[model samples]
Target chain A: MGRRNDHSRQEIREMALQVAEKIVAKEGLQGLNARKIASAIGYSVGSLYIVFENLDDLILQVNARSLDQLYTVISKTEQQCRQPDACLLALGQAYLEFAMEQPQRWRTVFEYQRTKDAEIPSWYRKKIFRLFKLVEKPLLEFMPTLEPHLCAQTARALWGGVHGICILALTGRLEIVGADSVQNLMELLITNYLAGLKNVQGTPCTPEEGTTQECKA
Target chain B: MGRRNDHSRQEIREMALQVAEKIVAKEGLQGLNARKIASAIGYSVGSLYIVFENLDDLILQVNARSLDQLYTVISKTEQQCRQPDACLLALGQAYLEFAMEQPQRWRTVFEYQRTKDAEIPSWYRKKIFRLFKLVEKPLLEFMPTLEPHLCAQTARALWGGVHGICILALTGRLEIVGADSVQNLMELLITNYLAGLKNVQGTPCTPEEGTTQECKA
Candidate 1:
C-alpha cells in the first residue's frame, strides 16, 4: 500500500481524491480527515497540501467528480426516453436510483459545506448548472412557449424537489412517513408538478394571488 | 452560566439541552461535542450520562424541541390563512422562514444521525407524522376526492420538495443556481405541483401510461 515517492504530484492528487471519495462513501463525510486520506494514499500530510490547497480543496475535488457522475447519469437517462414527459420521469428515476445506490457520495455533493470566502469556481458552477440544463431541455421540449426565465425557475424547482426526495430517502426520514418506494414519491412529484405547470395558460401567476412578492418573482 | 451545583436532576437535563442547542445553533452540528456541552453547563462528563442516556438522547431532545417550534409556526400560519390552498402556501412560506432564520437548528432535526440500534421512539415518530398531517389536511381540503393513500403520498412529495429547496438555500448551493428567493422557489413548486394534480381528470394516470408501478402507487 505504501507507494510513497513513486507517484507524481498530479498522480498523488488523483489518488487522494479516490481515497477521499472511498472514505466518504464508507463512513459518510464524518470519516474524511486529512490524516486518514493522506495516510491511505501513501503520502505525508505535507504532500497532500502540496497537491491541494487543504482538506476542503480535496473534498471539493471529490464532490466535483460526483457531480460529473450525476450529470452523466442524468444525460444518459434523458437520451434513452422518447417523450420529453417520459424523459422527465426517467431523469427523476435515474436521480433517485443514483442516490439510493451511492447514497453517501450523492449526498456529499449537497452536504459538504465549503469554507467562507472560498468561492465555488466558475467551472464547478457550470457543472451544477449543466445538471439544471439537462432538466431544462426536456422541460422546454415538453412546453414550447414557456418563458425563458420561467423555464429556468421550473428546472430549479423541479430538480430541487427531486433532490429533496432523495435526501429524505437516504436519511431514513421517509421510512417514518411510510413512504415505501422512493420511486412513487418521485413519480408523484414529477407527474403532479408537470401537470400543474401545463395548467397555467401563459404565465404561472394568477391575478388573485398577486399579493405575494413571489407572484412577480 | 455556572449553576451546576444548585440545579436539580431535571434542571441539569434542561440546562444541558439548552447549551447543546445553543452550540448547534451557532456552530452547527459540527461544533457539538459532549465535553463542550458538559463544560458549558458546568458539569462533568460523567454527570451528563447520569442525566441523559447518552449524547444521542440529548440531541434527540433538542431536535424534538425544534419540531415543536416548527409545529407552532406552521399551525399559526395555517390558522391565519383562510383557504386550504392559501394555507398550504403559508405553511411552505413559514417553513422556509423558520429554516432561513434558524438554519442549523432546523437542519439538525434532519441531519443528526442517531446510533445504529437506536429506534426513534413512538413520540418522535408521532411528531414527524404530525408535520405530514398538517400538510395532508390542506391537500385533502383542497381536493376531497383524492384517495387516502394518494393524499399521504402527495403530502410527502410536496413537503419533500419544499425541504429540498430549504436545504439548498441554507447550504448556499442555491446561490450557484442564481436563485434569489427561497419563497419564490417554494411558491413555484407549490403552484405548479398543485395545478398538475388538478389537471388529472379523475385518477392521476393516463390510460397509455399504465406500465409504471407508481401509476397505481
Candidate 2:
C-alpha cells in the first residue's frame, strides 16, 4: 500500500502540473487555483497538498520542468550550429521561438517574481540561471575581445533584446508595428546588435552607412 | 441623485485602482482580487462592480492608466534630446527607468493577460502604435537611405529589445549578470541595434566580429 501511494504521489504531481499548464495556457495565470486543479483531476483538494506543499510549490515544480525543456532547446540549437556567430544567432532564435511556440509557459515564467524568501522556492532561480549560462557561452565566443565585465553587460543586453522581441511578438504587440513574421523581426534585432558590437571598440566603422544596399530577410 | 451616483462611481473606481496597484506591488499579480481590493478601500465587494463591470474591466482601466503614464515619460524624455539617435536612446532609458520606478505598474501591464481574449484591447493597440511612431522619427533620421518598410521593421526590433531589457531588469534577472545600471545596458543595446539597421542592407552582420567603438556619453 505504501509503494502504491508513492507511485500515486508522483502521478498526482504530474497530473497537477499538466492541468496547471492547460489553465495557464488557455485561461491565463489568473485561472490557476487549487480547487480548479483538483476538479480537473477529480481529486480532493487535500490530496494535492499531500504531494505538493502548496500552490506555490506546485507552480515552482511546473516552471522547473518548463525551464528544463527551454534548456534543452538552447543546448540543441547551440550544439547544432557549426559557426560560432551562427551559433549565437541560433541561440537567440531558439530563445524567441520557445516564447512564440509556448506563450503561456513563457509568460508565467516572466510574470512570477522569484525572490530570496524560503517560501518562494529555489528551483526557480536555479532553472533561470542555467538558461542564462546557455547564452553566455555563445556570447563569449562571439566577442572574445570584450572584458569579463563588458561581456556580462553585453550578454544581459542581448538577452534583454531577444526577450523584448519575443514578449511583444507573443502578446501580439508586434501587430501595432506591422511585422509579417516574428523571425524576420528578431533577425534584424540580432543582426543590428552584432553590428553594433563592431562599433563598441571606438572604431569609425559603418555597417550600413557606407553601403547603399537594401536590407532583405 | 444621478450626478451623485456618477461622482461616487468615479471615486470608487479610483480607490479600487489604488488598492489593486498596492496589492500587485506587494504580493505579485496573483494577489489581485475584488475582495481584497474592496477591503483595502473600506468598501463592500459589490461597490467595485458598480464602477467596473468585473475584475477584467478594472485591470484594463488600471493598465490603460499605466500605459498613459509610460508614454508621458517617453515624450518628456524625447523633448530633452535634440538628436534623433540620442532621443531614441533616451527613450530606451526612459522605458527602463519607468520599470525601476514603478515596478508594480510595469508588471501589471506586461503580466496581466485577458482571460477570454487573445486580442489586445483596441485602445491599447492605438496607444502602442503611437509609441511606435515615436521611434520611427529617430530611425528615419539615422538611416536616411532605408525605405519606409525597412525603417518600420527596425523600429519594431528596437522596441522589442528595449522592452525585453526593461522586463528583465525590473524582475532582477539582470542582477545575476552583475549589470550595474539599466542605462548602460540600454545604451549598449540601442547602439548595437542601430548599427545593424545602418548596415543590415549590406552583407549579414555578426555582432562580435564588427568594429564597435565606445562612444563618450
Candidate 3:
C-alpha cells in the first residue's frame, strides 16, 4: 500500500508476522527472536518494536491467526458431517490433522510464556471459544436436552483430552501410552465420552452444581 | 560416598541433576545448561561432560527423576482411595497438585526436544509406562470384562486428556475454555468417560477392531 520502494506500517506488520511464523516453524519457540524476525522482514529491530509491543506481543498475534485457521479447519469438518456424532469425530480428526500439518504454529499458541500477570486479550480468547463452539455445536445437537453450562464444560473436557492426545502424538510420545494412531485414540475418547454423557443425561444438573463432580448425581 | 576432598563420579552426576533441576525450577528449561550446573555443583563444565554424555542426557535423567516423583505421588494417592472411581479422581488431583508444585520439571518432560534421530531410552520410557499402569489398574477394576487392549487404549485416551487439561491449567490458559477448576474438568472427563465405557461394556471389542473407530459397532 506504500510506495513501491517502501512498505507501509500495515505492510511491515504483516511482513514481521510472516517472518516470525517461519522462524517458529523452522526452529520451534526457543529459536524465535526479535532480531531474526526483523532481519528476515528487512527491518530494524526498532521497527519491529514500533509494530509489536514485544516478542510476546508478536507471538500473541501469530497465535490469534493460528486459532482462526484452526477454527476454519474445524468449521469445515463440522459442515461436512451430517450426523452430530460423526461431526464430533470428524472435528477431532481435523484437529489432529491441523496439528500435524502446522505443528510449530500449533505448539507456540499454547506453549508461549507470559509475564506472571499478562492477561490474554479478549478478542484472542474469543477465537478459542469460537472453536469450542464447533465442538459444543455437535455436542448440543447430539444431546439436545443438555444444559448450556454443562455443554460448555463438556466441550472443554473432551477437547482438552483430544488436545492432550495431539500433544503426545506430535512429540512421538503417544507410544508411551501404547496407542498407534491418534485417530483411534481420539475416536475412543469421543465415542466413549459421548456414550457416557448419554448415560448421565437422565439426571439434569442445576447451574450451581453443574461444575461439581456430583453433577452425575 | 566420596572423600571430603572429592566427589565420586556418581555423586557429581547427582549434584549436577539437582543443580539442573534448580535452574529449571527458577528459570525454566531455557535457563538449564551444563555450565550452570557445573558452577552450581562446584565442578568445571568439563567434569560434567565426564560424568554425563551431554545436556540432552542430563535432561533425560532429570525427566526420569520427575517421572519417578510423579509415580510416587500418584501411587500414594492410589493407595489412599478405596474405590476405583475415587482413585481416578484422586490421581487426577494428585497430578494437578504435582504440576502446580513443580511446574518446570513437569513441563520439561514433554516440552524438551531430542535430536530427530534420538530415541527415548527404554529405561526412561519404562517410568512413563509405569505411571500409565496406575491409571490402567483402576480402569480394569472399574470394568472387569473390559479387554486388556481396550483398557490400555482407554487409559491412554483418558490420561492424555487429563494431561492436556493440566497443561492448560498450569499455563493459565484453562480460563480460555471458561472452566474455573482443573479438578472439575478432570472429574467430568473421568466420570463421563467411565460411564460411557459402562454403557458399551456389553458390546465386546475384539482386539482386531479395538483400535478402529468401528469399535462402537
Q: Which candidate is the best by DockQ?
A: 1
Interface RMSD of structure candidate 2 (Å): 6.3
Write one digit per residue (lDDT tens) for candidate 2, span A38-151. Answer: 888877789989988878777777777778888988789866776565777788778877887787787777666644563434556667667777767767776677666677
TM for every model, in the order presented, reads 0.89, 0.71, 0.89
Give the per-residue lDDT digits (tens) of candidate 3, residues A80-118.
Answer: 778787888888889999999999889888888776777
Estimate, for each residue in A4-108, the C-alpha lDDT of model 1 and write its tens digit. 899889899888899998998889898899999888887889999999999888888899999998888778985678888788988888888889888889888
Candidate 2 regions exceeding 4 Å error are: A1-58, A119-127, A202-217, B1-65, B104-125, B176-178, B201-217
Candidate 1, residues B104-129, lDDT tens digits: the string is 89989998889997998999988888
Candidate no. 1 TM-score: 0.89
Q: List the residue pairs that clash in candidate 1.
A: A195-B196, A196-B195, A196-B196
lDDT of 3 by residue, B130-160 (tens): 9989999999999897777778888888888
Two-chain DockQ for each candidate model:
0.58, 0.34, 0.56
Q: Sort by DockQ, best first.
A: 1, 3, 2
